[model samples]
Target: MSANGGDSKVAVLVDCDNATPEILEFALRVVPQFGRVVLRRGYGNHTTLANRWQEALVRLAFTPCLQYQYAAGKNTSDIALALDAMEALFDERADTFCLVTSDSDFAYLCRKLRERGATVHIVGEAKSPDALRNASDQFFEWVPPTVKATSEQIPALIQKAEGSKKDDAKAVAKHRPLFVVEAVKLLAAETVEGKVQLGPLGTYLRRTYPSFSPKIYGHSGLMAMLNTYDRLTVEQVVKGSWLVSLSEASGK
Candidate 1:
């Protein structure tokens, strides 16, 4: 998704065979950030849809695209999803697409979508491969609700597990990539106060790195991840807005 916002008709196609019912919530939450979602569909066989996804499909208002396997082991759902996406593209129903799956098989689909001038965003789990992540314009890692912790709770959990603040900081820093800090510095340089708003900083990071995710560093969200860093400070400038800047120890 582009940093500059506009009305881009979005088609959200979920591979129910590859993605769980829990991830649908996260996919829906983030899809609106790109544009108004025009099409929401889930593709799977009869057993797949009936088992755990029937309730989720109805609750989320996703039209089910049922594809029964003619062969014993062959996955016909993927082919059906790919075909529907291409049809939506040719029909001019969507300019942006969200492929909700972690499977690398969709990398080719992403490439084709991009070639035809469609913006593709892949919303998948942390286990999503580099090939799939790289193929899309943006990749949003879907952290399960059970594992998601608030910014306030993450530190307490870290403290209880590590038993030392120093060790906790080290562990977090080791997992966090250098590009996150570099991105902060880059965005901060443009501001007169040498500080970047948390919202825009997150947008900048996502735009700059498609695979970048707070979940990769064991944090639930951007604020939680940023709060773990010792070299940066996050302070609320108003009720809901936060300002993120380098700490004095960073010497930047």
Candidate 2:
């Protein structure tokens, strides 16, 4: 990180099979929160992938790791990513790691990074499994920059309400508030009071979901967005200071 604490040296690794060029771009944008992105690399079976990925990675100055499938029904891309992560860890090439993929296969990789005391940030589609998202220090959902996000783009994966568990897709489509609830629940668990402070809450949300904004949800600001949800309780203890608690119905 920079002397003032606004910079960090980061290495961004991508699972090309499960990610798109745009998603990688979004993740790159968020990496600066931790520090400068010093290294960029992507792993995939480049032979079969669309040229756009190869073109994008190169254009962005990322090392394109080509992992060929040795045999039929084999996934070599994940293995390449895993090995590279371990190499980067031992080599001390980067202080922080940003993994861009929605696949649960990388869950163990994220866990290992955390175990080694490295900051692990995951950028993936919201349908990512509960275990996968919770494994990282933070998980970012890739919300498209323009146009409203459709249910297909972000399915409410974890923290489904009682009645909604049976069909999470419908829940995400019917009630978009669960997205915020899920992230809040994750942060709330680490706090002793089970309440997330306003400042840290916004910071975490922004750091995790770079595209997050109240206006995207039709609200003026973070507080306004929190107020619109019945599952959350937003309280102000001082001017420009507040606390957010997940309501009982939130199933925190």
Candidate 3:
């Protein structure tokens, strides 16, 4: 009872086999944006949950739904998760459901939940299939934090890459996504001063491209990634608040 005026109930179900425990925090943050998360559950086999996810589950206060494998090559965890989601839907325990997985098998489950008048959100990796992403009402691409470069080191890294013909420069350009540049310009045009807030910019990018992530471009976060490009201008209007706009050269 602590989000969106404590009215909407959100259920977050994680498929541990498909996603890692490190993404738990990111997934939880996404829940509050929609509503108060009432149910937090993680479904996995004995080995999957016990070995890697035990600490995260306890820290996040998530109920562990363990599924034993009776036969080889069978994912019983998926069945258990789907059953619980249906139960929650029928029992009116939650109006919104967030499935944290990249598996396309849950596409059917997402559609079923939506058919029953429930909002379905997906928090998964860049590898999530189009079927699964499209099934959910909103899809958030979970970009695992980069281990190579810290956020503080990004500005220096950006400076080092400028006008270089080395392999490193090619590597950076290879991961640079064009969709981000396009989104900033498109979103900026709708505003009075051609500036877009960080929150809405991120939401629009995630909604339009389910796999969009700054980590893919070797940046720690969105701001670091935006700073890599010269065609975009990022400014801090308030503490922890950012405004992004297209540069004069790139704007229409």
Clash number for every model?
Answer: 0, 4, 0
- Model 3 Cα lDDT, one tens digit per residue, 11-128: 9999998898987887887778688889999999999999999999999999999999999999999999999999999999998999999999999999999899998989887678
Candidate 2's clash total is: 4
> TM-scores across all candidates?
0.66, 0.64, 0.61
Best by TM-score: 1
Candidate lDDT (C-alpha), each = 0.84, 0.74, 0.81
Taking the tens digit of each residue's C-alpha lDDT, what string does model 2 give over 1-252?
Answer: 335325556889988888778887778776777877777988888563557597788778888888888998899999988888878878888768899988999999988887887888888876688678778876778876564454434332223368755454343333345678877787888889888888898888765664455544544468767887888888888888888888988676
Off by over 4 Å in 3: 1-5, 147-252
Candidate 2 similarity to native, TM-score? 0.64
In model 3, state the lDDT of residue 3.
36
Determine which window of 10 residues in candidate 2 has minimal summed lDDT: 151-160
Task: Give the Å shift of residue 9 in candidate 3.
Answer: 0.3
Query: Can you rank all candidates by TM-score, best first?
Result: 1, 2, 3
Give the Cα RMSD of candidate 2: 8.4
> Which pairs clash inside model 1?
none
Candidates in order: C-alpha RMSD to true structure? 7.2, 8.4, 7.8
